[model samples]
Target: MKLETEIKKPSHQSEPDYVTGKKDEIKSYGFECTDCGADINIDFQRQIKYNWTGNTDLISESERTELKKYYGIGLSEKSHDGGYPVFDKIVCKTCGEEYLTYCGVREFSNSAYSIHVQEIQKIK
Candidate 1:
């Protein structure tokens, strides 16, 4: 299937309201294996125990500093909450090849959250 980013839903309106409520736009992300072209769906809530390493070399110094500040700890320290700058390695089921997956969630002021898959690089 093609990548779908946004889904629109009808908003609730109160009684005797003449104006139409704004539709809520939900955004999501999908991932596909780079090597085998297989669709991969990640359940971030379930797969919380995956090994995450601080591969600082993959990112720039400024990014590393930002991540450290966001997580309130050094990149070398373990973080249970999967925030930005994810450095976890995931294995593709179809190709049996390991890939370094970087993903995160962004929350908007309107209470809508979006998932972002920044990079998926195959490990040699």
Candidate 2:
């Protein structure tokens, strides 16, 4: 019988990982029903750290890039207190129930806090 062993090396040098908000803030959001005409709102103060506003606005290049990294969640942008940018929002198609339901914010995550990233760590 024969046994073989292989050594693995790191791909990159050691670097401190950052996993926090670039800048913490709240982005508001509003929802509107397509069928009816009802309106609603949701506050993403803690989740994504953004306020809720019912309007559409252009996102910044850096913000867009950050959002692209995340699958579901974005950054916080605000034009004004009442006219701030919304992170996430959703509306019912079948019913006319418009409600604010979305928090669009993405931040770098640490392996320690992330379940998906810590899967291997759970092993004995």
Best by lDDT: 1
Candidate 1: tens digits of C-alpha lDDT, residues 11-63? 22212111113254223234677667887654443122221334333445565
What TM-score would each prediction reach against the true structure? 0.39, 0.23
For candidate 2, the clash count comes to 22
lDDT of 2 by residue, 1-124 (tens): 0112111111123221112342532243333434464553343343233322222233344543443343222343422121222322233455633232212222334311100110000000
Worst 10 residues of 2 by lDDT: 114-123
Please give the distance, in angstroms, between residue 47's alpha carbon in candidate 2 and its true position after superposition.
3.5
Candidate 1 worst ten-residue window by lDDT: 10-19
